[model samples]
Target: GDSDRLKVGELVASLSYPFGRESSLSFGIISRRGRSRSVSAGFDFIQTNAGASAGSSGGPLVNIKGETVGMVTMASQNGTMGFAIPISVIKNLLPRLERGEKIVWGWLGVRVSELTLEAADKLGLSPAKGVFVNSVVAGQPAEKGNILPHDVIVAVNGVEIDNPREFTRMISGAEAGSEVRLTIFRQGGLLQRSVILAPRPQESGGGREG
Candidate 1:
């Protein structure tokens, strides 16, 4: 019964006010969920194939039972696909929005990629499935914590990391000034370090989390 959670292939519909056309119904289904597109601070969106026209956003996307599941955010450049911010995210930020507070994003300030088998072999890792640190932004949490480039992160707070999304998920939930423990693989050795997170800078951009 949770509106925040949805399954792939689930039936979904929208009531849009596209170009001032209110109450216009479009039929479609959830193509995917928990999709994050890079933007300011970034938010996970529900991917749908629901047809929408100009101004379709600011409208409600509903489930079969007429529950408002999401709100249209943008259409693809070619209008072939649509993205909607999950209502759960809005609800989570509503309190701050209501209080007229600026939204803050958790910042780790590190760019990462998936560990490839070749890289694993180069790094002497077997069966590599961990996240690889590509770069670290200076003056940010990762850099401040001495998370150098080429350090392969294997875990966070004792939880094994399998991909970049898991890494972002862990950091996104963290508050500024909160300390996080990271397990890193550097030069054929495993090391652990504690990092204190900071709020994302005003001009920062979010990375895609699929």
Candidate 2:
């Protein structure tokens, strides 16, 4: 995803009650984007100084006209700043909640790491960006799709990916039984493959953490 989805200068609004009386409006911007550095394995979060509070929990944080973006959940005790899960990710999760369905992830059974310049060059890649497939499970999607070790994935479903986080993010967004197109650079050439994503088999021994 790109910053275009978020309009920084636009007034980001939220409902709050400083004294827990009645709902009051507060505003901020897309202060920052990306995950909280402290959460080792969480989706990207939006950082804002909007007056979120405990009483305001579950209230929609939105744009000026109140286009739902996120729920007011946390704030700093010292009134320094606050955090929010981005609307892009929220839009993906709320539907499941409404359906009373649990969130599940499709596992590829691969342990990948971001490729460094030297490592990418060793693999004959023209550019040194994206995640490198370190290993793949014998019978998982990575293996089934012939995602070879050392392959540098540059995109998923036509979306350009430059890191392991983005790679996993794109895959997680895809629905089970649907197909995803992958762009990979291997040896000295580029390759494209379509993988029919399957729900991570619960019985499978190998898996990715959800």
lDDT of 2 by residue, 34-136 (tens): 4422111224445576754445555567766657666665565666455555666666577777999876555565777878888977877766777888887
Can you write out model 1's per-residue Cα lDDT over 1-210, one digit (the tens) per residue? 244578889888877866764467888878867443332334455778774556778778888988888888767667766777777767766787899976655777888888988999999977796789888887888887899999998987776777775576656655566667889999998999988778866676454221
Give the clashing residue pairs of candidate 2, or none: none
lDDT of 2 at 169: 54
Q: Against the true structure, candidate 2 has what lDDT?
A: 0.64
Candidate 1 lands at a TM-score of 0.65
Residue 192 of model 2 has an lDDT of: 96
**Which residue pairs collide, candidate 1?**
none
What TM-score, over all chains together, does every model reach?
0.65, 0.62
Point to the candidate with the largest lDDT. 1
> What lDDT score goes with residue 64 in model 1?
90
| Residue 56 displacement (Å), model 2 | 12
Displacement of residue 29 (Cα, Å) in model 2 is: 3.7
